[model samples]
Target chain A: MLSAHDVTRSFGGLTAVNHVSLEIGAREIVGLVGPNGSGKTTLLNLLSGFLAPTSGEIRFDGTAVSARRAWQPSRLGLRRTFQLPKLPARMSVLEVMLAGGRLPAGASPWRSLLTPGAVRREEAAFLDKAMGLLAEVDLAGLADHPAGGLSGGQQKLLGLAAALMDDPAVLLLDEPTAGVNPSLRRRMADHLRRIREGGTALVIVEHDMGFIGDLCDRCLALDKGAVIANCRPDELSGNQQVVEAYLGRRRPGVPLRVVAGGTAGAKSSGARA
Target chain B: MLEFCLHVLIMSAIFGIAAVSLNLQAGTSGLLNFGQIALFGIGAYAVAILTRAGLPWPAALLAGMAAAALGGFAIGRLGRDLAAEYWALATLAVAELVRLVALNEDWLTGGPQGIGGITGLFPGLDGPARALATLALAAALLLATALTARRLGETQFGRVLRLMRENPDLATALGHDIVACKVKVLAIGGAMAGLAGGLYTLYLAFIGPDQLLPFETFLIWTMVVLGGLGNVAGAVVGALLVTTLYAGIPFLKDIVALPSDLTGSLRVFAIGSIVLAALMLKPQGLVPERLRRLHAQRP
Candidate 1:
């Protein structure tokens, strides 16, 4: 389980994440939903140890990880994926997956040189495992292709596969479905369910309300770096604060009909006009 | 002519070793190390200074390697939070600092005049035979370094390095201490460069502050780029081609009757042109690194 308590991060005078406290239980799929600049991604970064919070604590499996290095959380089985996949140029897709796997004993330069035969064997085994993961993500055909050459959707899939390589206990995925196709998105929703069933917790940041409502058990809606609503995913559309925050609060004299038009000008001018 | 040929071969081998070392750092690890010659210089100076202090040749050589490695580790540590471009600038500054120290320290480094008349490894052999013996040693070390570099690229350590190079954030998020990885890469590369420097001093029986110039680092970069940035074989080929071109320039001067000072300028121009042409025409160099098709392999 992972928990963030009163975590606030400020850049200059502007607070990006303000007094955010949340808990992720084992195998739970928590959807983080917010408008642009709502601090969803910043929250993910803070939770994943990519950015140290300005104040408060983030504990993973009861270990305080707020001051730890970004790699330290992942070493404790807290993994994450970027909104834009971070695949390097000239590196093959399969190699990316292998890098995500359990750090091999042969990863030590001394062991690699001293017992090359064992290193080779370990690499061969990892290679096989990587291929299987690639197949699962339908990226097996592109395994040898340069990762940099992958399309946005494919790169997202590769990011997921790579994160899964180490069998992480918790995965913080930022916009996994943003560039993905509808069919692939549906398949991914199913795959994520299967992953959760396999005991891996997931915190997904997504813009697609339908995807979140359909796939997530619970959803947290954020507005201006503060949590506006915390409710079951299906109840999100009906939550007044969530709707007001996402759709914008209606003017005092404006008819609900005019507000439904959802334009700045239309909302400012009442339906009576 | 034989002596000239031997000199070219020996110099090519020595520079070849340094080039391969640079490729490992710049190519594989994605470190933009403009201080490479400083690492090389540290070894050369360590050998020259420690040997003059009456240390045994083997001990002095090892000391030189250790010093270079330590210097490299320091560079890695200092550049930990810097972006690649800034880190590169920092390395350049570090190298210039080292050169200034060598130039200013007269008693220890023999000043800009440098230490000379040092004993060579094969001093017992007659002139041609001695040159041949040195060539043999240089060539053997070059081969060993190239093979070691190749083997290193195939290992798990190499995979992590490549990952760190490409995406440090992702590599770190995947449970790798990229700082530690960077330090290890630099130390390893520094040791290799140090070895090349030691061999260089041993062969020429001399070393000076002039040898630690930033231009010397760029020369090795040219070799790495010409040979195909990440490929060990390419670095060697590039080193051989460039060193031979440099050595052959004196003969060109004799044939063309060029001014003596102009010839030195000409060498710089020639090297600059080759690097420019290589970047524009064949950016991958003569021998590009082979990408591993791990999916094609069976368990």
Candidate 2:
């Protein structure tokens, strides 16, 4: 489980994430939706240890992790995927997965040299584990291929696979369906479902409303870095304030351009418009 | 001619070690250590200083490596939270700082005249024989270094370095202590370079601040780039090829009418040209870095 208490982050004069709080239960797939710069990613960064909040406390499995290093949270079984997958360009697809797992014995330079046979033996086991992860993401064929050479969707899948290697308790995915095709996007939704069933909680920020609608048990909509609504995913459309936070002031007889077919954008304008 | 070739071989072997070290830092970890020569200098000076203090050769060499590792850890600390470009500049500043200290600390470092009467691998051998002996010792060291580097590359540490190189954030999100990883990488690389420096001082029988210039750093960079950035074997190949070009140029004195200074300058120019060509055309170098296969264990 993961929870943030009134998390607020600022940059110079601009407050990026302002007094936002939410909680994710075990095996819960919670959808996080917001307009551009609504502090969705920034909040995720705060929770995932990529950036420290100016004022807030985040707890993972009952431990305060607000000051933890970027790597610390992951070690605590909390992992996050980047908005733009920053996969190592030169590493093999399999190597990417192997890195997500625990550090093996004899990682020190001299020990590695002294017990190369042992290192190799462990590596042989890692190879099999990585192969299985790759197969889950339909990337087994590209295991030996350079990870950077993958398409955007495939890279997303690879990133997912890499995180899955950690067998994390919670995953903060920035945008799971951003560059994916229709079928792959559907597959991603199914994958998230399976992962949720496997007892892994997810906090996903996405513009693909249909995917969010299908995957999320509950949805948290953010506006100006604050939580505007928390309700069942299916009930999200009935929340007038949530719709207004995402779209412009509602006209008396106008059907708003909202959540259009789970696309990357939902033709919405904020209150300023 | 045979003696000249042998001399070139010995020089290449010394350079080969530094190339391999740089590859570990830069190629494997993406650390742009512009102050690598400083670590090299640390070793060279350590050997020169320790040997003058009546220490045995092996002890002196180990001291050199320890000094370099200490210096590297310090630099690595400074490099924490720095971007790659800033880190590179910081490393350059360090190299300059080391050179300045060596230059001003005349009583300690022997200033420009340098320390001499240094021990050799086989002091009694004739020119060719000594060269051959140095080559043999260098070969053994190179073998050990290559195997160690390869083994390091195969371990989880190496994987973390490779992953950390291009994607520090991603590696961090996957449970790597990014700053700590960088520090370890620098220390390991610095130790390897220190060993090379000690060997250089032993083979040349002299060392001065002149030998630890930024130019030496650039020369090593050229080799790593020319042979292939991430490949350990490429580093050796590049070092040998470039060292040969450098060593062979002086022999052109009798055949060509060029002045000695011009010939020396010409070698540098040629080296620059080759690096330029490599960057422009074969940026991956003669051998590019590639991830090792998982083998047929599961495939």
Candidate 3:
């Protein structure tokens, strides 16, 4: 469980995230949606400890975590994925997965040199774990490929796999389906459902309305860095302020609930297509 | 001629040690340590000071390594809040500060004249035999460091360091303590350079403020860039090549019939040209680093 109380972040005179409060309950999947500059990603950054808030407090489970640095939150079983998917270009997919595992005792320089045989065995176990996770994502076949050479969809899948390496309770995913293919996107939605079933909470920020609608239990809509409405994914378009925020103006006769394919409020059945 | 060639070979071995350490820091971990020579100088001065104070060689060497490790800790603390480029310039300043200490503190370093008559390993041997012994020792140490590098290249620690080199944020997202990684890397690298410094001082039987210059750091840089950025064997290859040319190029002055005054400048020009050519031909150096792989059989 994670909660934020009236968090605000600013850069110089610009208040990127004005005053937003959010709570992600255990095993709950929440979609954060807004226009291009409505501070969705910035809000995620603040919650995940990438950016300290100008004023407000963030708590994970029950501990005060506002001043903690980026890596600190993950140690508390809170993990995040980058919006643009920043996989190391030269590392193999499997190697990237291994990096997500707990930092081992063999990682120490002295320990690595003194007990190389033991270290080798430990690394073998880590390799096995990473390979298992790759298979879970249906990527065992491409584990040996250079991460940078993978397709965009494959890269996003790798990011997902790497984040899960920590086995965190709370996941903050920034656009996991941004550049993925339709098939992988569908698979990802299925996987996200399974993740929720396994009792892991997720705070996802995505522009793919259909994807968000499919995966999210509840959706939080934003307008000018503040919460505009909190509703079900299917009920998102029906909200009046959310419609005005997306269209930038209210229509005389049009309801603004455009829930067709690729339209603003595309409806997703929250099931495999 | 044989003596000069043997000495050059020995110096390259020492430089090989320094280059290997530099590769671990700058080439793999992406920490630009312009103070590498400062750490090296710290080790040399520590050993020099301790040996003069009646400490044994082995104890003196360990003390020197500890001294450089402390300096590395300082770099980590001071560099935590700074950007990468600024950290590099800060290291350069650290090197200058180190050299100034060695120059002004005549009680220890002997200033510009340098400390001399430092005893070497197997000091009873003749010039040729001593060269062989020193070379053997250097080779053994280099082999140990190389083996360690290879072993690390296969582990999670090495992967994180390599990842940090490319994109540190991704490394962080994976739950790696980036500053902790940097500090450990710098400390280990500084220790290696310190070891090299100890061997260098004993081999030359002299050290001074002149040896603490940033140009010395660049020589190790040239070796790593020439051989390869992320490969241990590449550092050895680059060190051998750079030191060979460095020792051999003076003969070029006589062959080309250049003025004696221009010899130093010509060597610089020649080395610069070689580096430029290498960059043009192979930007990643003679051996580009390969992706680190886990040895698990595909299932």
Candidate 4:
């Protein structure tokens, strides 16, 4: 459903994403794994049209979409969630999702003021759709809550629900499980799986190897802004470069420990464990 | 006492309109506009100029609102990319520029002599007609603004505006044309300010550059801050209270033999103290925005 050909982005002299190519098919959950500053999020930004690639071609549903503005790409069914979960502090969770639902295609000021009945009808439909999406993410009860009031994990879920409100053909999520609790993380993974099954293409950036392994159908690893490996989850985990990049070689007598616990320690240890 | 209450109600209704408009820009849109008085000034001048041009009161009032909206559109376009402190500075500059224009523009604004003899909403009728008309006009504007605020609160545009205020980056990523939305709101808000200016001109039967000072801008800010920043009802209440204190404090001089000249300064001092007290006591204003209530209910 989405394709990036030789995408390259640079900041001054430093290249953030270099000649990276990726493809995400409909109903596919593709995992993008990398260390810090590896350009996974940058790649997502370029694809979602938040940042224009210095050089590359991005195609969404067979149309070239590399140079459009962020909001413009959204019309073409390209949606994204930020790594930081950019929820508006002044807006309720429902309002935020309604914003997504009310994408330019759904409402305009002129139409809204002139055709109140039609706008109300569409608004009701959109509200139902937003409510359903919120329920899917277990945020139905928190719909009236301000988006800023959500816990980190809940905000991440709401972010995904908001993206889904657009009825996106492809959703790009940046670090969905980054700061979430383990249970919430697991739920997020499961939700991603359901989203994939429901036929939307997903490209997820994550540091959690377990999440990638559990939720993704295919995985790609990046090192220094370049793709190092692209394969099935098991193969990706075992790939020599991927393993080397994520887990440096242990000394001969240093016992390699795989500490498994909650998300807080896991995140800290996962970085340099 | 009854006269004082009526005066308070009238002044409150006027300020409520200003505060609501200011809140729409600053509280909801997150645009630090320090030049709102410019729009207010334009509104008053529009009415003044149109009335001098022999237009009827109602037509002059609408013309004033249109003028202010046009000014707002100009400012919004000019300050579109400015953020935070820079935006505030730009708006302040614009307000000063407008004031200067009003002061120097002789033929149109009467050039410092000010404009007077402007008729009220009803001219032929005596006390009751004039008072009723003023009250009715004020009520009509307040109701219109309240309805507008309610509609905006529920709409997608309102959500985007709030998102833009909190985090423009997120709003942009989520498919909001932040600049366009800001411009739209700014113009609409300017129109409201203009409406207030028109009403003020009719009520006082005068227009002067002195009314467009930065101090007046701060007064509007004070009203919004006293009322919850994002709460429409809070703005209304705050406007009423502030206007009452402003109009009534002069009576204190009659009771206490304070210097007559000190009344103006004391009234301003009183307003500043009240604002400071409100900030300390209820920093979120009398009625905080509904977002807080929603969030508080969350598990």
Candidate 5:
């Protein structure tokens, strides 16, 4: 559903994302994992049209979208979320989601003012869709509340819900679970899985290995702006380079402790407290 | 005394319209438009020119609104590419350019001589009929503007504008076309200023380039700041208070021993002091935007 060819981006003398190319078919959930200063977010930005690739062509659903403006890409079925949830402080959660829904094809000044009944009906439909999306994200109760009042995890959920409002064919999520508690992170991962099952492609950038392993169909690892490993989640755990990159070196003398009774459920309940 | 108070009230109504428009562009849209007076001047000139060419009052008034909207559209286009401070400077330049054009375009505007002998709102009416007509028109404009402000404030468009003000990056990420939204706001605000200008010309039956001066721009800005940024009702109250002070303070010369010239300077000084005090004590004005209300409501 989304493809990039020879995508490379540079800032001044620094190459942020160099010669990176990837593709994800429909209904596939792909996780992009890297250490700090890795080009995961930059690659996502380039794909989403927030940052123009210095030398690359991005094709979304077979149409080239590399040259399109950031604000126009969502209409072409490309949507993304920032690492930090960027909700407008003044807008209610429902209002923010409504903004995410594409503007009607015939929305012009004359139509807006002269056809009040039509506008009202369109608005009601958009509101209903947004409300349904909010319910899916478990944020229906906060629909009327200003989005800024939400906690960090709730704001992330709101952001994801907003992306879903457009029924995007491909979603580029940057660090969706960075600051969220494990339980909410799991819920977010589950939401991604459900979205993928519904035929939408997702490319998620995350640092949490457990969440990515559980949710992603395939994991792509990057180091120094280049892909180091592209493997299945289970294989990624056993890859020698991946293990060394993440943990320096595995020691035979020290046994790895597998903590018990520390599921995402416990974390979420603690967060509620 | 009653006649003077009524005149002051009428002038205040006109100012209220201008202030509300200014608040829409500056407060709600987060644009620093320093050329609101230019729109007013465009409105006044449009009305005067069209009326002189034999058009009816209503048509002339709407023509004036259209003229101001065109000027606003031009400024909005410029505002799209420019940042706030640059946009403010560009608007000021545009206002001055309009005034210069009005001054030099003697064949159309009659130069410094100004336009006069224009008909009143109700041409055949005398006394109460004229007063009632003017009051009714002003009240209607105020009511319409208030409704527009309220509706726009509650809209998805308004939320996007506010988002632009708070975080341009997030606004873009959320799919708001910032430049288009800003232009729309500027055009709407310019239209409001034009309406005020048409009303003012009808009341005074005169138009002059001096009316579009920087002082006039500052006065509207002061009204917006004093009333509260982004609060349409506050603009009304602020305009009424400022106009009352502008007209009422001159009456104090009748009771005081001060000379007219000294009292004029003293009034100017007083206004400056009040603005400074307002900036220091209540920079947000008496009625801040509803977003601030949300902040206060939070735990």
Candidate 6:
């Protein structure tokens, strides 16, 4: 479980996220949606400890993690993916997955040198585990391929596989379906559902309304760095402010809620199509 | 001819030890350190000073290694927030700063004249016998360090370092303390370089500030590049090749009746051209690094 209190992050004169607070419960999937420059990614960055908040406190299962290094929160079982997946040019896909596994002993230089037998055994087990995860993401065949050479969609899938390698308690994904094909996007949705059933929580920042509407249990809509709507995904269309933010100013004669509802349906349908 | 061959072999093994260590840092981890000689210098000076203060050979050698490790750790710490290029420049500056200290501190470092008359590891043996013993010692040390470096490279620690080199942010996301990893690598590399320095001093019975020049660091880099950057065995071979070339180039003066001064610069020119050819023709070096297979034999 994770919670933030009045978190704000700014860069120079730009206030990207202002007085935003959020909580993510165990096994829950929360969708973060907003138009461009709405601070969705910034909020995710702040929550995942990739970037420190300009002001506010964040706690993960009761431990303050704001002052900790990005890696520290990760050790506490919180993991995140970038908007554009980070894959090194020289690293094999399997190597990337192996790096993601939780094996502190094998990571120690001393243990690696002095007790190589133990390290080898640990590595063999992890190699199997990583291979299995890669298979789940339909990347088992490309395990030996240089990760940087993979297609964008494949890279995103690899990113997911790598993050899952940590067996993280909470996973934050930024636009996982951004460049993915429709079939792969559907597969990812199924994967996330299984992950939630397995007791891990998720926070997804996405512009794909249909994906968010179908997958998210709850949704938060933002405008200009402030939360404008907090409701079930189905109820997002009924929120007047969210509609105005997405579809622009309402016509004077018609009830804005109905217009908002109609447009949300059209948008989600178009997105799915 | 036998003595000349042994001299070349001994020098190659000594420099090979340092080259292998540098490979672990720059080749394996992508640290791109440009101050490698400084760590080597620290080791040499630690031995020189500690021996002068009446410390035994083995103890003085270890103390030199520890001192060099500390210097390496300091460089790693300073580069924590720097990008790769800036960090490289910082390493260069630190190396120059170190050379300056050795240059200016006359009483401690014997000024430009350097310290001499240090005892050799095998003082009782004379002539070729002593050279043979020193060659054997250097070869053994090189073998040990190379094996250790190779073992470390095959482990998950090596995978983590590759990740750090390739994508520091991603490595961090995977819960690796990258700064700590950098420091650890530098320390290990520094210690190995230190060992090589101590052996060099013991082999020659002297050391000077001139040996710590920035050009020495570039020579190590060329060794790493000429061998596959990430291949441990390649580093050793590269060192041998380069050292042999350096030693043999002066012989051309005899055949061609060249000017005396030209031989010194000729070696540098020959090395520079070989590096360029290597880069353009076989950028992966003589022994290109292979990707670690998941089903590869366990180390």
| CAPRI category for model 6 | medium
| lDDT by candidate, in order shown | 0.88, 0.86, 0.83, 0.82, 0.80, 0.87
- lDDT accuracy of residue B102 in candidate 4: 86
* Candidate 3 residue-wise lDDT, A105-211, digit = tens: 56677777788777777767777777877888888888877888888787888888888877889999999888788888999999888777877899999989999
Tell me how candidate 6 scores on lDDT: 0.87
**Model 6: colliding residue pairs:** none
Name the lDDT value of residue A258 in candidate 4: 61
Q: Model 4 off-target regions past 4 Å? A: A62-68, A86-90, A103-114, A247-273, B1-7, B291-299
Higher TM-score: candidate 3 or 6? Answer: 6
DockQ of 2: 0.67
Determine the C-alpha RMSD for candidate 5 after optimal superposition of all C-alphas. Answer: 6.5
- Candidate 5 structure quality by residue, lDDT tens digits, A88-146: 67667877777677655213444455566766677777777887888899988887788
Q: B84-156 in candidate 4: lDDT tens per residue?
A: 7787899999999999998998888888878888876678866655676678779888889877865675567
Model 1: per-residue Cα lDDT over B1-299, one tens digit each:
99999999999999999999999999888999999999999999998888777777778888888999898999999998899999999999999999999999998999989988777686679789998988998899899889988888877788888888788888887888898889988998999899888888887889999999999999999999999988889999999999999888867877998888898988999999999999999999999987877767553
TM-score of each: 0.96, 0.95, 0.93, 0.89, 0.87, 0.94
User: Can you write out model 2's per-residue Cα lDDT over A1-118, one digit (the tens) per residue?
Assistant: 8999988999998898889888889988899987778888888889998888999899999988854577889998999998799677788888888888875564566667777777
Model 6, runs deviating above 4 Å: A250-273, B296-299
Q: After superposition, how far is residue B1 of candidate 4 from its true place, in Å?
A: 7.0
Q: Which runs in model 1 stand beyond 4 Å of their true positions? A: A259-273
Chain A TM-score for predicted structure 6:
0.90
DockQ of each: 0.74, 0.67, 0.57, 0.33, 0.20, 0.65
Ten-residue segment with the worst summed lDDT in candidate 5 chain A?
A: A264-273
